[model samples]
Target chain A: MSDHAKVIKKHHDHHAHAIAKPGKRLMHHVPLAFVLKKVLGHGGRNVNTALNLTSYIDFLLVTVIFLLMSFSAGGEITVDKSITLPNAENVEDVIEAPMVAVNGQSVMVDGTPAGNTRAIRDAGKVQKVDELFELLKRKKELWSSFHPDKAFPGVAILQVDVDVEALVVKSVFQTAAFAGYPNISFMVRKRAKAGGGEGG
Target chain B: MGGVDVGGGGGGKRAVNAEINMIPFIDLLMVTIAFLLITAVWVTNSRMNANAQVPGPPNTEPTEVTTPEKILHLHIEEFEFKLVWQQGSTVVAEDKVPKQEQTDKEFVKFGDLAVKIAEQWQQHGGHQDPSDQKTDQCVVHADNKLPFRELVGVLDAIYDKKREQNQADGTIKNVPVFNMSFSIR
Candidate 1:
């Protein structure tokens, strides 16, 4: 609808008062008139009007597809906007576990800042990430308490940026490993197509 | 395209029977398509389970390490990947592969690395067919300059299911990644 039409329609909020009396006959003959009034807007703007339904449908379809693709994607693991994960073809289903996200500057454990990536880099040596290790250790202990009979499943997801340094990755991995988590999952974006690429 | 009379007329006037009401059908079809596409996102883009054993910190009691002989160590440099194969107390083999860009034709740099990894696996006490063994861990020591994308590309190629094509009978094999862990300084 044009902006002028929208403005006029807003003023005619009570379109059901008098002019819509004739619309009842149109509605009885064509149920689609009611549908169009509900979906498109009110005031019964020419029930017999021919519209380019193809383009309207195309627009709705495209909007729906984009919304569906990204809406609530992997609720357990939020697709971090800051980190660009590497694309990989061989991936398994996501396991619900403590996730450690390492971007360019900092390391966040389950969305909480656990350690400083810059500090680790400046250290110039492979040092234990004490903050991350303690968080993971607490998590492990909590899990063990919950399941007294079963062993604590030590699974963690490493959602690191593709451009992150290897030293930072290694530090996080070692911290998680030492904190009693052994089974690690690398969070990777599924490749759009399988081809003869670097697996790149 | 059957339609009903427009004004409830029965005096032999022309009925609105010539029009096909395709708008409602199109609306229904598009709504269904939109619904299915949105729900399927939850099931896609999962994790790569690397049941890996990373080399841990000092001053802590160490866990059981993989046998020295069976370790396949890959050291990543800016442009070179140094691969060392250690079997039993001695280093069995050593090789280096240059990094190739994604646009490299016929063979990218990772393709060569995948082939070398297979050859090493076959020679280093693998089954008569390299495809038979689906359990092998690779320890990668990467430099600070190397991007994680390059590392993962190599890792994906190493464990690719099709990497076992050098078999005699020509049957495809499962992936050959028992665990893939990174090493520290």
Candidate 2:
């Protein structure tokens, strides 16, 4: 073969070989020494990939702060489901004390069942409820024992249903007074504004 | 651009492992939101206290008896509220306020009654006594058949303070006029 023809044939063969193996062409683009260094630098261990938790933690912290601010730290009285309180615009925060709940058919003192309201009313003119008096007296004694130096504050909280008659409420009040609770407070739902307000 | 090729160039740089596990994060947020919602409801239902001092037994008697001070009494009935002003044992003035008629709901009207009480307070020289810094005291006697709401309305009427707004400066001031207590008749 002539010298020029042989040189062209050799060039074509090299081009065909390069096209057949694309990986070899890519390897030529990157240094083999650099690739070996990267592979060996990792020590053949898989790198850990995980979700970034910083944002989630920040959100949780914000929520916790909001909850703490909203929490009512003052001793909150648990109201019975049976009693519905009257709404008042001007009232103060309640202090910690024993609660006396007077519902439609029953009365409970500190969540303990005192007596049935209807039975007490029907039991021939009850000026003072015996069961409630006993319970309150017991509570007072217990409190007195705990605070030997201080006198009983005689403070009691009354949770009476708005639908209950005034007479029944009066009896409960008198009974609490006779049991050494002279300073009574009524638990009321707070109204937002002054006159013509709705219950909270 | 000159970095080592980790894999054969069949595809471009292998897609990065960008998938973030979201199950736990979503669960945490859901729980926090639920807790906040529950506490918000509870905060709205917090209780407010209204105090009443029960009349105790007579502790002591004055050695020298003098004329007793005048007292204002409020009598609450099912259909009406009666106002009685007394000095010692004599009744000085009396008035009655009837319930307003309503078909849809029960509403107690006390604006007129409040004006009358204010007038009586003025006539009695209640604001004149410097020693009496506090408002006049009122005793409320509610009927047995009366509902608690009605009684509260009567008390509120007697004890509600008036707010006077200053036009010159945007400020309001409370004019405390009465202090009240309740009793069952």
Candidate 3:
């Protein structure tokens, strides 16, 4: 072969080899090596890689924070942490703690009757009258103590019969408020007209 | 030429390459948000234990009273309330509170019952004097299903006379009826 022709053939072979393995191979090697190499072996290569890591970590951290905040903000209010309230045919939307339940002649505290069976029928025995007030006073103190940052004189929840006389129900409030729980609330079944039914 | 070539290649080495893959980050965020929402809901749910056995405070003994006036015992039934004032076997008065129209009436049904009771109370020595008084207390036998607000309203009506008298006498206003008690069956 002629000298110029041989030189030209060798140059063509070298160019073909270069084309076979381009900067993509170098890029793949650099990224992998950047992950493996430390300050000792690859002088600051890991530090350069750390810059990318920081961006992803920041994204993860911000998202986590946002989620935590949203979770706390979306807390719900429930009765005894269990009973999803039932909608009533006639009532209002009122949420109260210490929900006093009055089923028939029974006077219940946190849904448990305070008096006995005979009293449940007659509902006139003054035997267990003081117990309800005493319980209420203690609860008022506890609620206040729970949120020591502020001052709440007392807390009570009064639930009465739908057919109960306004005067009779009023006397109950007067009695409770007189016992020092001026901050009282009433539990009512929301009127089922609106879509705000007390379901989950 | 060499520096220009390097600068042209450096366009691919932009600092924004370190930015997180936003799609994966967003996916994780959504999952985390859902998890937080569920947890918050759970935590808030366990707050009120409706089944908890919260009993009324225990009473040691009943105290003796000097003057024992007839006590009006009110029984709250499902559809109506029965009021009876009695001491021993003698029934002073027994009246049933009727059910009023409640479909569109803003006021509660038995609201008039309170008024009637108040009128009767006025007729029967319903004097309000902070200095001295007659009967020790008036015990109300309330039903467990009645709403607390109604109970308060009833009490307010019952004590309206005393409140008015107190206002006239210039005592610290809004004084609650101290001579009231409850008998929850």
lDDT of 2 by residue, A1-200 (tens): 99999878988786655546443233444657767555456445567755566677678778877876877645346789888777655555677889999998998998999877887556534368889999999999999999999978998888888787777777887788889987777777765544463211
DockQ score for model 3: 0.09
Each candidate's number of clashing pairs is 2, 0, 29
Candidate 1 chain A weakest lDDT stretch, 10 residues = A191-200
| Winner of 1 and 3 under DockQ | 1
lDDT of 3: 0.48
For residues B1-185, write the lDDT of model 2, one tens digit per residue. Answer: 11233444435666544445567766777787787666563633333323345666686866677776667887766667688888877998887777542211333336555556666666662443433344566777876766776665555455454433243355544444555655644
DockQ of each: 0.32, 0.22, 0.09
Provide the lowest-lDDT 10-residue window in model 3 chain A. A81-90
lDDT of 1 by residue, B1-185 (tens): 32445656457886644667877877776777767664655535567666546344475666687755477888877777788876765877888888765632221226677667766766663434554544566778777656677767766656653344244667654445435777767
Model 1 Cα displacement at B84 (Å)? 2.0
Q: What tier of docking accuracy does candidate 3 attain?
A: incorrect
**Candidates by TM-score, descending order:** 1, 2, 3
Tens-digit per-residue lDDT, B27-98, candidate 3? 676687667656764322111101111234587899576554666665656666676767655877777776
**Per-residue lDDT for A122-168 in model 1, tens only?**
98777789999999999999898888899777899999898787778
Worst 10 residues of 1 chain B by lDDT: B100-109
